[model samples]
Target: MQIPVINRSRHALPEYQTAHAAGLDVRANLAAPVTLGPLQRALIPTGLFLEIPVGYEMQVRPRSGLAYKHGIGLVNSPGTIDADYRGELQVLLVNLSDQAFVVQDGERIAQLVVARHEVVAWQPVEALSETGRGAGGYGSTGSA
Candidate 1:
């Protein structure tokens, strides 16, 4: 699906790295490098604004390479960007490692994936249907 986007940053628009890639790699649009000390978080902008079609939303996710190599991850694993939102796309990044990490301009910090969603209508029900393992909380099932 074709999306309408406005890129105000110096870098080009984000695109899929591979033919089968699901998410487009998003970069940081910073005037200067921002350093993230241990356990510190920052809201980095992308200088991008776009409109998503109704019934769909944009998901902001962390890159696996960054998480594995530098212990860099997103505060909100999969942040939702509503279809109605028309503001600059920003990422909430956190440094999980003990050392500091620098967020350079045009660095591939996060990814943006467009997803389809359903509008659910709440139905007032007296009770939910019983399952084979009813009310089974975490770790209730056997570890295989």
Candidate 2:
């Protein structure tokens, strides 16, 4: 599953930290530190461009350590990058804590997961097939 990528940042290419990890750790590429106040969000650049396959997509996800320790997370959790896009990968991050969080250069900020997708054609029908819980949504099943 090798994909073509251009690393324009100062950091090394993204890699899986663990053997069984599904996502690669993406780093931040910045000239200086960018601080985000409580509830403030910013688009942090990665300086990475990818030539993703036509049937594949890249997903930007949040690191659990950052979310649990510093209360920082991605605004668009699992931000999708279509295969056709050839732009810098920027992470939309928000400070969810009461303090300000500084984004340093070459800091690990997010995760990148490349996955294959299916292109479905318009199958216009009168109604969808019935199920045991048809139309059940938003906690309709049960509470945790």
Q: What is the TM-score of each candidate against the true structure?
A: 0.96, 0.95
Q: What is the lDDT of residue 131 in candidate 1?
A: 90
User: For candidate 1, lDDT tens digit of each residue in 33-87?
Assistant: 9999999999999999989999999999999999999999999989999999999
Ten-residue segment with the worst summed lDDT in candidate 2? 135-144
Task: List per-prediction Cα lDDT, in the order shown.
Answer: 0.95, 0.94
**Native-structure RMSD, model 1:** 1.2
- Model 2, 14-93: lDDT tens digits are 99999999999999999999999999999999989988999999999999999999999999998999999999999999
TM-score of 2: 0.95
Q: Candidate 2 local accuracy as lDDT?
A: 0.94
Which candidate number has the best TM-score?
Answer: 1
